[model samples]
Target: MAEIRIENLHRRFGDFVAVRDSNLTIRNGDFFVLLGPSGCGKTTTLRMIAGLEIPTSGRILLDGEDVTFLRASHRDIAFVFQLFALYPHMNVGQNLAFPLKSQGTPRAEVKARVAEVARLLRIEHLLHSPVGRLAGGDRQRVALGRAIIRRPKAFLMDEPLGTLDAEFRDLMREELRQLHERIGATTVYVTHDQIEAMSMADQIAVMDKGVILQAGPPNEVYRRPATMFVAGFIGSPAMNFLPVTGPVAAGAQTIAVNGAHVTMPKLHEPLNHDRGVLGARPEHMELADAASFRGRVFGVEYLGARQLVTVDTSVGRVKVRAANTGKAKAGDTVGIDFRSEALVLFDGRTERALASDLMNGAPVEGRRAAHG
Candidate 1:
């Protein structure tokens, strides 16, 4: 097991900075995931920890030992790339045993380790088959087996399931989490897919634009985002934001929104600025008899269990997730109700989040924007 710590880590490529001012800690036997969009520096951060990419500044410590300048081979960590980089000519057994053999372990021990990992991954029956002909899922298992056979101090994975079909990827997510629990190794997984990170990680660090925005348990990040970037980035279908278009001040009970008179929410303190964005998740809005607003149904998506209905309101377009009762359809008029308990407010000018300490009926600063 390994306790990985990164302090003020940074990496720059000339005029462009890939990762900056990053500080994070991965405890021993923890399933930590680095999540972000492409070019957001998630992968770059992982490469640095694996000793594949040297940081421009900062330090990396493992179990109280500073190994900031160590080479990849000397780090005693296993890295699993997204694309399987196994030897095509070698069969499953050779591929799995290669790492152990490279260390010149006894022949008997290599065989024993290969067999143990193969059984653990449920790929023992394919040990003699050529890796070139294996299915994608099987290939992934072999890749994982190779890493596991070595028993490295820590495991670094960069979207190991990126190439698999959606169905298999889902299955592998559970398998990977189970494997982490069984082996109890320090793991750092990197992926752009939020579902993958949310499902498999014990802790998730959401990254963007070369910064660690928020790092916490998946539920905390989802429920309490620190900024507009995080609030909009972490949720499915994204977050619905309505901007107050007019000038705002510190205290206002009601404001004009989308050409409609809307009541403001009670915040813990008066808002610093009136002009800001109001946020609501689709799942929070519901159809009500005593609706606060009305809009024309623009689109209705049937998601089997529920229907995501988009409405064109005077203020702007709003989406609501309702039961699949099939009563609402496109072109229909519906009374929209905002769940006061589920609303969030953000700063309009900066677009930063204000929902961490507050998530409810928030005051608007100006007229509602057409698009938020």
Candidate 2:
């Protein structure tokens, strides 16, 4: 196990800056995930750490030793790409033993290691099967086994499960998590799928446009995003944002959504000088019997245990998650409530969070008077 640290990392291509000055510390045996959309520099960051791509300016440290200039073969890292890069002509046993063979391990040891990894991955029965004969999931497992056989200081995975079917992907996710627990190897996984990041990572780094917006546990980033981009990016159904114009209240501010007044929780930082945007997740917004705002249900989607209803309000269209009791339908008049505890305020101009204090449930002072 090894700790990975990046200091003032920057990557550029001529005049284009692929990655900005980024700093991060990945603890020993930590399963760190770099998550973002495509072209967000996540792959570039992973490659730099793997010694496959050199950073324009920065230092990378593994186990407290600087390895920024180390060659890929000397970095002591295992890289698993999205595509299963197995040799088609080789069987599973031969494929797994290839790495040890290249390193000149004794024949007996190579055979033992191959058997051990194949059994660990439940692929021992398929050891003699050709790489082309294995299913997609099996091939992926073989690729992972090959990477693990070398026992590198860290494992770097770049969307290794992107090509698998949904069911296989889900199964592999649990398998991967269990494998990490068993080995406790330091790992840095890169993916655009937020669900995978949320389920598999010990810590998640949310990135956008060559910059990391926030890095923390999954719940922290979801409940209290540091920026509007994160609030919208980290969740499914995303987060809903509404523009409001009003003075900050004494204890808290209230936004006039259409004619309905919705009180906002106090922010730790003053937000009176700039316009405030209200953000709430779909689960936090609900149709209730005695909600403050009234709206008409525009659509209802049945999703197993819960139903998602789209409500057209005077403020805007908002989505609400409710029990699938089959009680709500389109064109029904409904009262909508925003859970104050889950609400977040942002600067309308800059789109950054108004206060980190909101994350910790602290009460903030109001900087302006309320308006009716």
Candidate 3:
């Protein structure tokens, strides 16, 4: 296993830029993910790393040696695609042995390696199965088996489980994570699915418009998003943004929203925007009688252990996650309160987070109920 370093990476197709000055260090034996929506250059970045696509500019270092211009075959990195790219004529065993065989690895060694890989992936029983007839999950396992069989310096997977059904994707997710643990190989995975990135990555780089928006561990990225796009992209229900009339000065502890003054963390830097946004995850809000932010319940969604209550506030509609309280109903007026530390303030013009208590690690003040 080896560290993969991408420095000032940029790729261009004619006049359009696909990746822009991307700088990232994928640690040795780390499960690093490039997460973003479609056309966000994640696959292009992964391809650049795999040596399948050369960068228009920038450097790619594999364990300190520059391999920016190396051929895909010369770089010892294995790439697994969304579509299981397997030989239709070969059996699973043959597919697994082909890389070694192509490298002129002796027959005895190829056989030994194929058997080892099959056992590791628990696909020994399907070794003789035709690749064309395997189930989606089984084909994915074989695809993975083929990648790992080479014992490459690193693994690059481009949505390897994208083609699987939801339930099987979940199953494969767990299996893939376990396999990574056993091998401890450096892996770079690209996906548009936040669930996959959050569940499997040791580190995540959130990208947009060919640029990286934020990068960190899953929890850190979720807790302290550097940009509004990131705050909205990472969570399921997404963060709720309440409009704030701004030009707010530094050190202010309150902001005006819909003619009501709401208590918030003192800002360390002034927001120069004519308007700003107060971001809070649904789970951070509570129903309190004395709270300043008031709204009328408009919709209530029962979600097993929790209920998502939609409220039409003075500013806009807001969703609050609370315990399955049968009490909330449409048209019921309620006061919405939130934890001060959990709030993220964004400059409306730039859509970037402002320095506040969120960045200072202030303890959360209050939540309606502990369980949600």
Candidate 4:
């Protein structure tokens, strides 16, 4: 187990930049996730950490030792790929023993380690099964088992569950989280899926356009995003951005959106841009009958215990998560309102989040809840 620190990490190829001025810290014995959409430089970042890809400029320190130019084989890290990269001809036990054998451990030690890993993963019955004949989930378990058998300083996983089906992926997600907790291994995982990042990561670094936009615990990133891209990328159905149409001064408690004055928490600073956007999550909004801001419901999606209701407002269309009681349907006019503490004002010009009491994690007392 070790702490991995990345400093001023930058990577370039020919005329294009793949990663830019990135700095991060993966704490010892923590499950850290690099999260973003496809080609957001998460994989490139992970490769650099694993010593598989060299950074154009920066430093990589593992366990307080500089390993910026170390070879992948000498970094003492195990990598697990999305597609299970198992030796097709080898049986499960043999695959698990290969790492120890390659490192020239005694034959008895290799056998003992193979047994330990199989039991730990609860795949003892499949130790003799051929890798080519195993199910997807079983094969993935074998891949993880092989990595775990190595006893590496840390584990670098690149979307290890990306190839599984939806239900299987969900199951594997839980399994992987539990495995990480039991082993207490330092793991750096890369994924484009927000659900996986939110549910599994102890810390998440949200990236976009080859840059780290925000990094924090899941709840902190979800509740208080650092930028418009983070707010929009980290949530399902995403955050709603309504255009601000009036001048907003420091400590202001209200703003005009489409001619209606919507109440918000007082701002910590004056708006830097003439135009701005108000951000609110779907679950934080409520449908009320008398709220000054109103909209027409045009879409209602059933989602098991909840429904995602889309309303067309004068400013923009907004999504609200409501109880699936069949009370909301298409073509209904509803008043839209949210808790003042849930709003995040962003500078439309820079697309950066503005500071506020709530955004700064202040506890404001006696705030009203949204309801219809």
Candidate 5:
């Protein structure tokens, strides 16, 4: 078990910054995930901690010691690359025991340890199977076993499941989560796949353009995003950013959007028309009576449990999710209604949520459970 901390970390190459000024603390034995799209610097930051890339500035602390300059071989850490780095010639058992054997451990002890890990990974049946012949999922398990066998202080995995097929990926996700629970090792996982991060992480840090936008529990980050980019990036269909410019109806505490009257969300202050954006989640919207906003259904996507219905409203195209059985068809005229309570206000200029306490029932006339 180990605690990893990065303080004032920055990594730049020539004129471009790979990782900007960032600070984070990964607690002991937590399944922490660094999530972001490509070029967001998650991998660069991970490399710095693994001693693969030196931070141009700031410090890297492991457990309590500063090891920013430590070489990769000196860090008591196991790094599982995205490629599932394994020797084609080595069988599953040999690959798993390589670490222990390299240290000149006794043959019996190494064999015992390898057996233990192989059983733990459920790869014991394939012990003598050459890695080249193993399935993708098995190969991944072998790769993980090789890392876990080291019993390193922390594990840094860089998109280890990115290459697996959908079915195998889902299976490995559950297996990996359970594996972490059984071992209770400190882990930092990096991936651009929101599903992977959302499902597995005890805590998730959403990154973009080298900056950590929001860091919190998966549910918290989704429910109360600090910036517009986060709200738009973390969700599946993403949050809807509808453009609306109209007079504030103080008498009704509502705003007219595209000729439809809808209750305005509580903001820290009244709207100053500073390019305001009304953000709503697909799940938070529904088809209602004709009194609400009206639109023409553009399409309906049946996504197993629910259907995402797209409507070309006066403001723009909006996506509303309903139970898969809900009757919605293309070219149908429908009433689009906001949940009222689920609406959020964002200042376009800053691309940040307006300060409000709307999530709580009290509704401070201004701004905060979770989708996942």
Candidate 6:
């Protein structure tokens, strides 16, 4: 296993900056994920790590060895692309052995390695099947098996399950998690699917517009986002941002949001900004009979055990996820409540989180609960 470190990483296409000055440290045996929307430079970053794309200015270190100029063939890393890039003419066993054959391994060792990987991936029975005849899931397994048969130092996967159906994708996610546990290889996965990153990664890097916004454990980045962009991008329905006019109190102690007085939380560093916005996730906000803000329900969607209600409030339309209580309806005036602890304040113009300021007591004016 090897730890991958990147420093001052940058990539540019003429005047267009594909990646900014990014730095990250991927520990050994970590199932790290790069998650973001399309064209967010996630793929470009992954390709750079795989030696497929050269960085404009940066240094890549593998286990303390500089490999910034290494070619893909000499990097001792395995990559599985979105498509299952298997040769149609070769059978599963042949495909799995091709890598070892190219490296000129002994015939006995190549056969043994192929059998071992096929059995580990549960594809032993289909080892002789032609690539075109196997199902999508089987093909994907074969592709993975081929990559692992080489026993590379690290594995890089780029949305390897994007072609599978929803059900197959879900199953593959669990399978990949189990596979990672068994092998414990240092792996870096890139995907736009937040669910995959949330469930599988030990650490997740949230990216946007070629820059990494936040990096931490999945829940930390979800519950306490470092920036407004992270708060708006990581969740399912996404966090809601509301504009509020407020005054900057002494020591940044308090702020008024749309006539509602709220106390600020204490911060490690002082924030010297005035105008800011409040952010809350759908799960953090609750519907109450007598609350501060009032809104009309635009629609309600029943999602098995939970229901998602869209409300047109005085501020704006906000989505609230609640239990399936069968009480709320469309076109009804409902009150909304949120825990002060769960609320996130950000600078409206810069979109950066504000520093906390409350001394010892509860920061804001609501019940407190750990989110997520």
Candidate 2, residues 164-279, lDDT tens digits: the string is 99999999999999999988999999999999999999988888989877787788778877778988988888898877665444356566655567766665565675377888
Tens-digit lDDT string for candidate 5 (116-174)? 99889998899999999989999999999999998999999999999999999999999
Better of 1 and 2 by TM-score: 2
Candidate 5 local lDDT, residue 223: 71
Compared with the true structure, what per-residue lDDT tens digits does model 4 show for residues 101-135? 88899999998889889988889999999989988
C-alpha lDDT values of all predictions: 0.81, 0.85, 0.88, 0.88, 0.85, 0.84
What is the lDDT for 302 in model 2? 98
TM-score of every candidate relative to the true structure: 0.89, 0.93, 0.94, 0.95, 0.92, 0.92
Model 6: residue 108 alpha-carbon error in angstroms: 1.3
Better of 1 and 2 by lDDT: 2
Residue ranges of candidate 3 with Cα displaced over 4 Å: 359-372
lDDT of 2: 0.85
* Candidate 2 clash figure, as a count: 0
lDDT string for model 6 (181-235, tens) is 9999999999999999999999898889998877878987787777888888889
Q: Mark the regions of model 1 whose C-alpha exceeds 4 Å error after superposition.
A: 245-270, 355-372
Clashing pairs in 5: 266-366, 267-366, 356-366, 356-367, 357-367, 358-367
Model 1 C-alpha lDDT per residue in residues 277-367, reported as the tens digit of each score: 7777888778764575788899999999899999898768888999999989789888876655555667776665542223333222210
Checking candidate 2 for backbone clashes, the offending pairs are none
The sequence of per-residue lDDT tens digits that candidate 3 reaches over residues 306-332 is 999999987899999988968889999
- Best-to-worst ranking by TM-score: 4, 3, 2, 6, 5, 1
Backbone atom clashes (below 3 Å) for every candidate: 8, 0, 0, 0, 6, 7
Q: After superposition, how far is residue 338 of candidate 4 from its true place, in Å?
A: 1.3
Off by over 4 Å in 6: 249-254, 262-264, 267-274, 357-372
Question: Residue 201 of candidate 2: its Cα lDDT?
Answer: 95
